[model samples]
Target: MPVEPDPTRRSHESWRAILDATFELLEEGGYESVTMGAIAARAGVGRQTLYRWWPSKAAVVFEVFLDKTNIGPFLAGGEDFPTQLRAFAHGFRTLYVEGPAGTRLRELTGAAQTDPDLARAMAEQWFEPRRAPVRQALQEAQKAGVVRIDIAPDTALDLVFAPMHYRLLVSGGPVDAEYVDAIVDLALAALAPGATPA
Candidate 1:
């Protein structure tokens, strides 16, 4: 008798194909045009495969969006926290400045405001993971007497990241290396021990 296919492994492979196809489509033809049929065709999987996995095209696309971006790996640079934090911001700025993924990210963020599920998923998946390194760095800085003991890690992350997100989302400004350095400088000033927010 022939060996049977593992259902779990098969399912994982199918979803992976769907996400890969979704990004290809997104990169080739923006988020607005990536249909379920297009994804299925590009993925070489049946349309039912896409449906069985995701609730909607947006959901599939959003997942692909996350996979295509380096929200985590970029944040966790190395063992050292400060170097990791700077590298994280630097890497993300490079992506925002250079890749098509940035446009997709902006679209997803705007959509998240109206789509509660997308918003929640993004918070749980993309946002939190990206903040983990910053949180770790903040904790270490606090321990080292570099940052104020009173400031929470989460707050520190927000203080550092919110401006970058705001610039990316609304101002449509260029996210450059200079911008990264500035954000890091500002974050340290605000959270550093004996320093007050100006």
Candidate 2:
């Protein structure tokens, strides 16, 4: 009798292939060029297999972005609020502002403006997962009195991350180490207890 193969292992391999192919296409040609059929061909998987795992090309690209970046580990680094915030900010900048990933992200964001479905999928699949660790870190900071207890964790996250996004997506400013440190510093100052309006 022939030995049975592990479905779980096969599934993981297929998923990896799909993501790798998606990233390669994104790096080579941005979002508009990355079609489901191309991804399937490059990944050596069926188009149906791609559809079975994801709803659209946008979804696959966002998932690939998340997989490639792996923001969780960076957000989880360091013990204190400032340290963790710095690490997360730097990691975010590296992933979204320094390379091909940045260009792909900007392309997707532009597309999301007209495509509500893609917008929702990106928020659910990419934004939420990336935000969770930062939210948790904020909660911990609040509990430890490092961050103001008055503000919601989500708001705190916005304070910390929104400027980076604005710089990357809208302002066209440099997102270098100095900028990251300044953003983290200002955010922390605002979140500190008894902080005053500047």
Writing each residue's lDDT as its tens digit, candidate 1 over 1-198 gives: 111225775576776777778888887889899899999998899988777767678788777776666544475544665667677778777666666766777788888888898888877877677666667776877898877988678887776677888898889786778888899887777776788655
Compose the digit string of candidate 2's lDDT tens values, residues 1-198: 111224754487788778889888887887888899999999999999888767778777767766765444376565787888788888888878767767777777877888788898777766777777878888988888888898878888788688888888888888888988988888888989999666
**After superposition, candidate 1 runs with Cα above 4 Å error:** 1-17, 41-49, 69-71, 75-82
lDDT of 1: 0.75
- State the weakest 10-residue window (summed lDDT) of model 2: 1-10
Whole-model Cα lDDT per candidate? 0.75, 0.78
What TM value does model 2 have? Answer: 0.74
After the best TM-score superposition of candidate 1, give how far the Cα of residue 39 lies from its true spot, in angstroms. 2.7
* Worst ten in a row by lDDT for model 1: 1-10
Measured by TM-score, the strongest candidate is 1
| TM-score for each candidate, following the candidate numbering | 0.79, 0.74
Enumerate clash totals for all models, in the order shown: 0, 0
